[model samples]
Target: MRAVRLSVVTATAAVAALTAVTGCTEKSSSGSGDRVVEVTATDDKCEVSKKEFPAGHVELAIENKGSKVTEVYVLFPDDRIVTERENIGPGTKQRVTAEVKAGDYQIACKPGMKGDGIRQNVKATGGTVAKRDPRLDKAVASYRAYVQAQADETLPLAETFAAAVKAGDLEAAKKAYAPSRIGWERTEPVAESFGDIDPKVDVRADGLEDGQEFTGWHRLEKALWQDKKIGAAEKTLADQLIADLKDWQKRVGKAEITPTSMANGAKELLDEVATGKVTGEEERYSHTDLVDFKANVEGAEKSYALLKPVAKENDAALVTELDQQFAALNTLLDKYRADKTSYDFTSYDKVGEADRKELSDGVNALAEPLSKLAAAVVAK
Candidate 1:
């Protein structure tokens, strides 16, 4: 329960012992450099074997010595999560590798897998300067431009949706909702970068927001589809949504996007479909989940498109598999499109139970291969 002070020799020996016991070399097991950091996570805190290290490739072999399920994170300045592992049960160990830049960062241990997390500062000093791969640099530039284009498209459509709501035109507002959301969904990471406005723009009605009034797309959907009317109160939320989106456009101008992040984003969008869309929780009121599903896939597809060149060059077989999976998954979804635009999109509710299961299976199939993309891109 007390703070631990592990000497570097002890930590090094511990890792070496672990390597011997598992019959694995540290570098091979972690895809990390020889430098290892033992991060011991407990019920309420995290203990680092080393308070500092030279910047570059590092691995944190996390030992969850906690009583409950927990997650741990290596954070950049201002608490941007760099890499994290979740759902580590009691007495389990998980390894997370990160290519860290020279800076001060924090270790966050969330004992319950939810919270701001208990944090402790750690430093990375000068070392062999980590150089960016030109391919990854090119991918990052392309992804950023995509986000900018999506944002540029989103603003005006948001205006139309907001105006329709203010005018009490439920039919028109409903028409505008899905299209407006496409650009926003494609730029999910950008929405997240703005912090305060993300939930306001996209939070589902679920209690996840800690009772934050659920004033986003689902909120507007309820007013439009369920109530069949948009009152002044509903119009206020619409105005705020547009306001937040415009703010996101400005803030995202300086935001960063990396290949690893791109891969994570793609995986996360698929995860969203599996966890939320399939369950119908996200589109509880309007059953607009098919719209969300399509958008998530589109966003991920764009990321994959950027990585395609590097992926093809390095792991041509894997790229071919992913390409095939994506095509199959899209073919499965194209069955539900009644037309070319969001205007004629089919609701997830219209699909029979069996058909929905088929969609879920298809998404998982793509996600299985898609999950390997980030590593391939990084390894390349």
Candidate 2:
């Protein structure tokens, strides 16, 4: 469910920043004296206030002056994302906080949220980031284990779904589909960090790149449900799907996991629910969005629960809000399922407009507080 609108350049080219300056001139500091890099994103250019800063927590104060919704990325020289803030609407402002090691990096702004973004070379210089709370380190370790476990579990379920597809048993494939996706949906942010993997394994038809072959779950999904025919091409895709998943499973342990990334990733899951599952764009044919939706919430909750000890110590009120909102959202979701413990739920197509609105509202309410989690967890 990644909206990978941009094609990444090669490692060397991705490190080179475009030389264009039409925005903020000098660097500034927040009232708390943290390094603040002001980013002005236009339709054709991405301007950063300063190209260098001390390594630790840096805040990107971004304003999208473009005519379209934009996305900003803090990327490794190899185009691996460190952290990102997506869907920044025209004329709106957003602030993203990220931790960085001392190294060369690029800040990319994707205007219209497509193609390789305008890039700027930036450097995180020498500075001692404060010693983190030991619990935060433990939280990261626990989350990493959770991510790998999800990846490990998902492959077998996906294999089951693929086996059914290869056999041309539509009913069996349909039965396996929702169960197969639960693990992936739960850890999508970690999975998506691989850059090359998500598009191959999960990309929807509309999210496809130019001339990109449709060969992921959605492609096979269309074959099973929409096209209502499983042929040679679909059989091939089913095998390819398992192959891609295996690649993801092998690479899962190497993903970058940090406290802020986990917090940011938790929020990203809600964004997924809001834009894809809730809108019925994801699982459009199968109407199994509720299953995916539940998984996203569970994933977010897992991260929050791990971080709660630190977050509560830092900002008790925010934790209170998160607890309430999570409970409320989970309760709301329960109404759709007759068997509360199972994945089975009323098909999304059977849900009414009013019910969808309530769901959307629940997500938005939780997302607002959830977005503050990174800052809270990192607070002294």
Candidate 3:
């Protein structure tokens, strides 16, 4: 959802390796120790400190020295994402911690947040990744089930939206739009892990690559709400949307899910809300930003709930803060709707600037504490 361009690979090629994480650890020529890699991103180069290091808990200390927003990725040979941090704004620094086994990988930086990005070959030499808590295992398993369920539930709803689009029923398609997006909004990072399907199904008009045709929900959304007609082109795009999503449905079970990734992904969801939903950039035509906003919160909360047990045991104070912040944000969101349980909220455009500022503040409050979740779960 953060507009990271990864359409270079065909969807078929992307789904070829459904599993992103490997169980086997390679023997490292270098002995096991903590590895911290420094990355400097500029307009033209991706500078990684070391090309090879022992694998285990590797931390990327990244600084965006460039003038434009950038994204950094640790990718498998096949371009499957190991872990990534997107939307690294200009002149900002972020530290990302990921567990890796011995393997060959590439560290890439997309200066303008587009294309395959500048790449450098890096190797995780033989080293053992430390064992995780058994409770963390349960968290991973439950989160995987939750991710898959969201994917399963999404396809049917998307099909309903596509059906209306195909039938040229403008009103029905409009009504189905926000509902179809809920599941995807909740589990977007899982969808994005594939590196191909997201661009196919969710790319916005401005997010398109050079010579890439725009054909997704937003395209259809534009036609229905802005262009005011569902013509043959719209119908064809509708079919494409469903086909792409069916591919996503098939691949959700194979995505890489870890406690840290869940925690990281939850933060990414909040970033998504802050950048897109809060700014009214997403759902620009339909004015349904609040619906997507709610879905994003729901997805983040689900991940937090799964990891809460271990996190609470590790850092009770952080857990308490997270709980308080989440409640405060939810309470703020609830004011937009008459019924708290439903997705039917006031359109984003109708919300005043004062209200939008409050929502933004609420997201920041929760996100600050939520950022500590991964470390909490990984604590000894």
Local distance difference test scores for all models: 0.71, 0.87, 0.84
Which residue segments of model 1 deviate by more than 4 Å? Answer: 1-54, 57-73, 81-99, 109-113, 127-129, 339-343
Ranking by TM-score: 2, 3, 1
Assess candidate 1 and give its TM-score to the true structure.
0.80
Best by lDDT: 2
lDDT per residue (tens digit) for residues 216-279 in model 2: 8999888888999899999999999999999999998899888999998999899899989889
Q: On a 0 to 100 scale, what is the lDDT of residue 211 in model 3?
A: 85
Query: What's the count of clashing pairs in each model shown?
Result: 0, 0, 2
The TM-score that candidate 3 achieves is: 0.91
Local lDDT at 323 for model 3:
91
Please, what are the lDDT tens digits per residue for candidate 3 over residues 38-89? Answer: 8888887787777787776677888898999998988777777777888889
- Worst 10 contiguous positions by lDDT, candidate 2: 20-29
Candidates 1 and 2 compared: the better one by lDDT is 2
Listing every candidate in turn, what is its Cα RMSD in Å to the true structure after a full C-alpha superposition?
8.5, 2.1, 5.2
Better of 1 and 3 by lDDT: 3
Q: Which regions in candidate 3 have their CA more than 4 angstroms from the true location?
A: 10-33
**Per-residue accuracy of model 1 over 1-380 as CA lDDT, tens digit each:** 00111111233443343334321112122323445777777776667667577786566778988898776666665545566555568999865545667787666676765545565567788965467678878888988888888888889998999999998888899888888888777767545543356666676655343435667777898888888888889989998888888888877766756676677667667866776777777777778788778888899899999888887887888899888988888888888886545345678788889998998998989887776676677563
Error of 1 at 32 (Å): 7.5
